[model samples]
Target: METSLLAFLLISLAKVIVVVVILLMAVAYTVLLERKLVGRIQNRWGPSRVGPFGLLQPLMDGAKLFLKEDLIPEAVYRPLYILAPIIALGCALMSIAVVPFGADIRWKGVDLFEIADVNIGLLIILGITSVGVYGIALSGWSSNNKYSLLGALRASAQVISYELALGLSLVGVVLRSGSLRLRDIVDVQSTHGLLSWNFFGGFQFVAFLIYLMAAYAETNRAPFDLPEAESELTAGYHTEYSSMKFAMFFMAEYGNMITVGCVATLLFFGGWTSPFGNLFPEPHNAILLSFLSLFWFVAKVFCFLFLYIWVRGTLPRFRYDQLMGFGWKFLIPVAVANIVVTSFFIGLRLPLH
Candidate 1:
């Protein structure tokens, strides 16, 4: 028993370290990705001098942010001001703890896909994400700046409004899968092809659309990014933050974007499952299967992330009232109706999975 406990502890530590390192690297590059994609959308060169195709731009940006002078306003609440970004960044990373990767791998009898396997992983992720709002609110309030406070209030309110729709959007999938375990939800779509998957096959397209719209608002992306509208908020809640502290806010944003994409892939899309399942048989070896599934999972996530940047570059930001009304009037009702329809099919015993 002692040996097993030791092994488990060590494995957990390793997983945490691995997740943080990879998450930060991915978040950094996501910044570069948004820049490059937006530049193309605008017909302009983006980060040409940083590196080849601006690949090293994230590294350069990180260095620059760190080297810049850290500043604090004497009028601001120092304790809360300092704690806000840490809370924001920490909660963002915390949500990733329960998220399983594209494929489960084993090392010395230890599964390395996730840090935790709680039965209510989905709830845990959402709960942690909600806590992130506090960080934003605190950052803005403590900054002792009017624009920062306004940005925080707007962003937090939008998040709360959309969160209802976001939660409701998943009810259909949960009803069909009959499980809150994210892995189980993914497994339900495994035996099916693209058309039979949850988003397309289960006739839950309406739920998918609601989730997509709510996700954009939840992450403060364009059309819903009114909180940080440059023309109005002057960089929003993080306006008073400088150097690494300011960098943390952006890191949190990008990290949340990745998390949102990952969740969307696993919940709505046939995560890690190949479109032509029969054509690509699972490898006889466990290691090989892990890598192959990893590829498919990453590919699906890439598409979702691309969609994020594409919409950001294309859509105009919604007016604050429009954003709120859309969430409360349209998204919430559609999500509720989608749930009703899903329950009807479930009652009729449609073999959705």
Candidate 2:
């Protein structure tokens, strides 16, 4: 028994380390992807001098940030200011623990693609994301700068307002799947290929739309990025943060972006499942199947990330009042309506008692 327990612990620790490393690498490349794409949108070359077509730019950027001087203002509250970015980045990475990236294959009697496959995986992600707000709020409050405080206030309000819509958007998926376990949710969608996906067959496309908008706001991306609106907040909540501390906030944002994409793929798209359904034969080889599953999952997530960048380059940021009004008067109501309609359809499809 002791031997088994020790093996489990060792495997779990290994999985955690691997996931965190991969996630950080993904976050770095995602920044590079955004910059390259955004540069093309403006007809300019970005990071070209750093490496051949800037392929090595993320590595250089990481080295630069690491070498930069750390700075802390004298007026700020020492403890919370120091703690804020760690909290933000920590929470962002924590949400991924329950996210499954590939097939349900096991090695050494442990999950090959996930860390901590909890029954309430969906709830756990939501809870961790909610807690991440504290990092931004604390950073703002502790900074002792009006711009920082204002940015933090905006972040807090924006998150509070949109988080409701975000959570509501997932209700239809949860109801349709009848399980909070992410693997179970994926299993339900795997039966019919693209049509079985929540975005299509399950008729949760409305929920998916809500999830997208709310996710953008939650992650402070693009038009909804009021907290860090460059024209207004002068770098916003992290304005007072510098060096590695600032890098933490930057990494946390991208990490959250990746997490959101993962959830979207799992809930709306048929995660790790081919869009063509069972049109193709299933391979008997477990190793080959695992690689194929990982490919599909990564492909879907890449598409989602591309969409995120497209929106960032194309859309204009919303004014503060407009942002608030849209969340409360538009998104929240639409999300609620989507939930009700989904529930009604789900009820109709239920077998009589």
Candidate 3:
């Protein structure tokens, strides 16, 4: 029993290490992807000289950030100011533990994919993500600067408002799938084929759109990035932060974007299900199917990520009042109405055509 437990522990640790490394790598490339894509959008070449079209740009950027001087303002709340970004990055990393990479395959009688297959996976993700807001709020308050505090306040308000819409928009998916388990949701989507994906139906497509927009605001991405609106708040909540500490916050933002994109893909685009269903069904081809499904999943996520970069270059920042009004008046109402309509359909056991 002791030997068995040791083996189990080592396996778990290995799985965790793999996940963390993958997330870190993804975060690094996401930055590069944004720079390149945004540069294209703005009609400029981005970081090509760094190392082979800037393939090494993230590495160089990371090195520079690490070597930079760390600064903390004298008036700031020392403890909380330092702790906030750590909390933000920690929470962001926690969500990925529950995310399934691909269909599970047995390896020595153990599932080789995903660290934990918690039954309430969706709830875990939502709860972890929601807690990340505290990081932003605390950072702002601890900064001891007017602009930082204002940015934090804006961030808090934005997160709270958009979270409601984001959560509500996903209810349709939960109701239709009849399970809160992320893996189960994917299984159902796979069984239903292309048309069965939540985004295929009209109402679900609207929910997906709402969810996407709200997610962008929740993450403080472009147009909705009022918290970091340079013109208004200088550098916003983390304006006073520098060096590695500041890099933590930057990494967390991109990490959260990838997380949201993955969740959206799983919920609306079929997590790891092939686009055309079992059109080429073969009992022994489950592994092949899984690969195809994962390919489609990654492809969908990449498109969303590209959209994020595109919007960052093309759109202008929203006015404070306009941002607040849109969330409260437009998104919230639409999300609420969507929930009601979806519930009605669910109650009637309406078959999705």
Candidate 4:
């Protein structure tokens, strides 16, 4: 018993470390990717001087941030100010733990590629994302500057407003799959062709669209990114943060984007199920199949991230009132209606993919 427990703990530790490292690197490169993509969109060179087409730009940025002065303005709520970024970053990173990267591949009794396979994985994901709002809200409030406070309030309000639509959008998916466990949702589409994906012919396309919009809002991405509107609140909640503290919030934002993309990929894009499932069934060599699954999973995630960066380049930010109105009035109602319609048809046993 002790040996089994020890193995579990060690494995858990390793997974945590691996996930954190990969996530941070992904966030860094995502920044680099956005700059390159956005620059290409605007027909200008972006960060070419850093290194080899600016591949080392993120590293240079990180070094600059670390070498900069760490400032804490007087009159701020000292403790919470310090704690807010940590909380934001912690919540962002923790949410990734519940996401199933690929189908569970066990070799001689030990699973690989996922940290937790909780029964209520969906609920845990929602809960963690909801708590992330507190990090931004508290940071804004504790900054003791009105601009920071205003930015935090606006950003938190935007997140809160859209969160309802986000959860409701997923309800249709949950109903269709008949499970809150993400792996089970993936299982529903496993072995089927491309249309088997919820985004295509599964009739959850509406939910997917709503979820996509709400996710952008939830992660404070463009068009929905009124939280940090430079024309309004400067840098929003992290306006007062500097050096590594500011980087923490920056990392949190990108981390949230990664989590959002991962959730979307898992929910609507069939997780790690290959598009060529007919050629490569799950029963084949466990090791080789697992690697294939990993490739497919990463490819889907990269596509989602690319879409995110693409949207940032193409769209203009929504005004504050327009952002709230769209979320609360249109997005929420559409999401709730989708849930009802989905539940009704699903309950009747319609032959949905």
Candidate 5:
């Protein structure tokens, strides 16, 4: 029993390290992806000089941010101001703990792919993500700046409004799958091909759409990114933050994006399931299957990330009123209606298959 406990502890620590490294790399390349995408949208060159088509641009940016002097504005709540970003980034990193990167691969008679296979994986993710809103609110209030305060207020309002719809949108999925376990959700998708997937059904499809839109808003992505609207808020709640502190918030945003993408992939795009499962039946080739699963998962996530950058380049920011109205009036109602319809259809037991 003691040896088992020690093994679990060591495995947990290793998982944390791997997740942190992956998140750091993902954040770095997310910036690169954004710059290149936005440049293409605007008919201009993005970063081309930094290490072969700007591959190393994120690295340079990181180095620059590290070398810059840390700044703390006068009259700020020093403790809260410093703590907010850490909370945000920490919560963001924590969500990845339950994400199954690939199917289990046995090595030395032990499964080595995922970290912890918690039964309440979905709940864990939702709870951790919900807590992230505090980081935004606290950062703004701690800054003691009017603009930062406004940004914080906007962020809080946005998160609250969208979270309702987001949660509702996911209800259809949870109900259909009959389990809140992340692995179980993935299993449902794997058994049902793309067409039979939750998002492919009529009511659930609509629900998925609502979820996607709400997710963008929830993450404060472009168009819905009024919280950090540079044209108005001057860098939003983190305007007063500098050095590693500001970087924490930046990292949190990207990490949240990856989290959102992973959830969507798992919930709708079949998790780590291959696209054409009909063609391939065997799941026993552990290493090969793991690679395929990881590849599919990453591909789906990258597509969503690209969509995020594309929207940022192509769309204009929403007016504050319009943003709120869209959430409360349109998204909320549609999401609720989708749930109702899904429930009715599910009760009828129609030939949904």
Candidate 6:
């Protein structure tokens, strides 16, 4: 028993280390991705001189941020100012703990894809993500700058306004799956392949659309990035931050973007499952099967990320009032209606005794 417990501890620790390192690296490169894509949208080359095709740009950027001087303004609130970015980035990283990236395959008595298989994984993600807003709110107040305060306020308000819709949008998925465990949700859709998927088979496309829009505001990307509107608020909440401190907020945004994509893939896109369903024979080799699952998961996530970049490059930023109105008056109602319609259909499909 003692040996079993020790093995579990070691495996868990290893998973944490591996996932964190990979997530941080992904966050860095996502920044480079945004720059390259956006630059091309404007007919310009981005970071071409850094390395072949600017592949090494993220490495150079990370080094520059690390070597830059860390500065704390004399007038700023010291404690919260330092803690804010930590909270932001930490929450962003923490929410990924419950997300499964592949099938429930085990190796040496350890889950090969996920860190934790908590039953309430969906709720945990929602709770952690909701708490992340505090970091933005506190950063603005602590910075002793009007622009920062305004930016933080916008973020706080924007999150509060849109989060209701985001949470409601998932109700359709939860109702369809009849389980909060993300793996259970995926398994439910796996039985019939593509036709059984939530977006198509479960008829939850409305929910998917709602979730996608709310996710944009939740992650503070372009069009919904009112909190960091440089035209009006300069550098926004991170205006007073420099060096690695500033980099933390930058990383947090991209990290949240990745997390959002993962959730969307799991909930609406039949995560890690092939669209062809049972058309292909399952590979007998466990390692081969796991690799295929990972490939599909990564490909779906990349599509979501590309959509994010495409929208950012093509759209204009929303005015603050328009942002608020769109969330409150538009998304919320549509999300609620989607839930009602889904519940009706689900109820009809249940066999009455």
Each model's lDDT comes to 0.89, 0.94, 0.87, 0.87, 0.86, 0.93
In order of listing, the candidates' clash counts read 0, 0, 0, 0, 0, 0
Q: Lowest summed-lDDT stretch of 10 residues in model 4?
A: 275-284
TM-score of 5: 0.95
lDDT of 3 by residue, 1-353 (tens): 13466677778789899889988998999999998888888889887997788899999999999999999889999999999999999998889888887776655544557788888998898899899998888999999999999999999999998888889889888988889989888887876578778888424988999989999998899989999889989999999999998999999999899999889988998877777776767346767756765677778888889888888989998898998899889988998898899989888887667
Off by over 4 Å in 1: 1-3, 350-353
Q: Residue 108 error for model 5, in Å?
A: 6.3
At residue 264, give the lDDT of candidate 4: 90
lDDT of 2 by residue, 1-353 (tens): 13488889999999999999999999999999999999999899867877788989999889999999999999999999999999999999999999999989987788989998999999999999999999999999999999999999999999999999999999999999999999999999998799999999998988999999999999999978889988888999999988899999999999999999999999999899988888988787998999999999999999999999999999999988899999999998999999889889989989999
Q: What is candidate 4's lDDT per residue for 215-258, written digit by digit as tens?
A: 99988889787767888888888889999999999999999999
Question: Candidate 4 has which clashing residue pairs, if any?
Answer: none
Off by over 4 Å in 2: 1-3
Candidate 3: regions farther than 4 A off: 1-4, 201-203, 282-290, 350-353
RMSD of each: 2.1, 1.2, 2.7, 2.3, 2.5, 1.2
Per-residue error (Å), model 4, residue 113: 1.0
**Cα deviation of 271, candidate 3, in Å:** 0.7
Kindly provide the TM-score of model 3 when superposed on the true structure, using C-alpha atoms.
0.94
- Cα lDDT tens digits, model 6, 1-353, are 13488788999999999999999988888888888998999999888888899999999999999999999999999999999999999999999999999998986778879999989999999999999998899999999999999999999999999999999999999999999999999998887789999999999999999999999999999889899999999989889999999999989999999999999999998999888898988888998999999999999988888899999999999998899999999999999999999999999999998
- Predicted candidate 5 versus true structure: per-residue lDDT over 82-108, tens digit per residue: 899989999988898888877656554
Off by over 4 Å in 4: 1-3, 279-283, 350-353
Off by over 4 Å in 5: 1-3, 106-111, 201-203, 350-353
lDDT for model 6, please. 0.93
Question: Candidate 1, residues 89-152: lDDT per residue as tens digits?
Answer: 9998999988888666667666678788778988887898889988889999999999999999
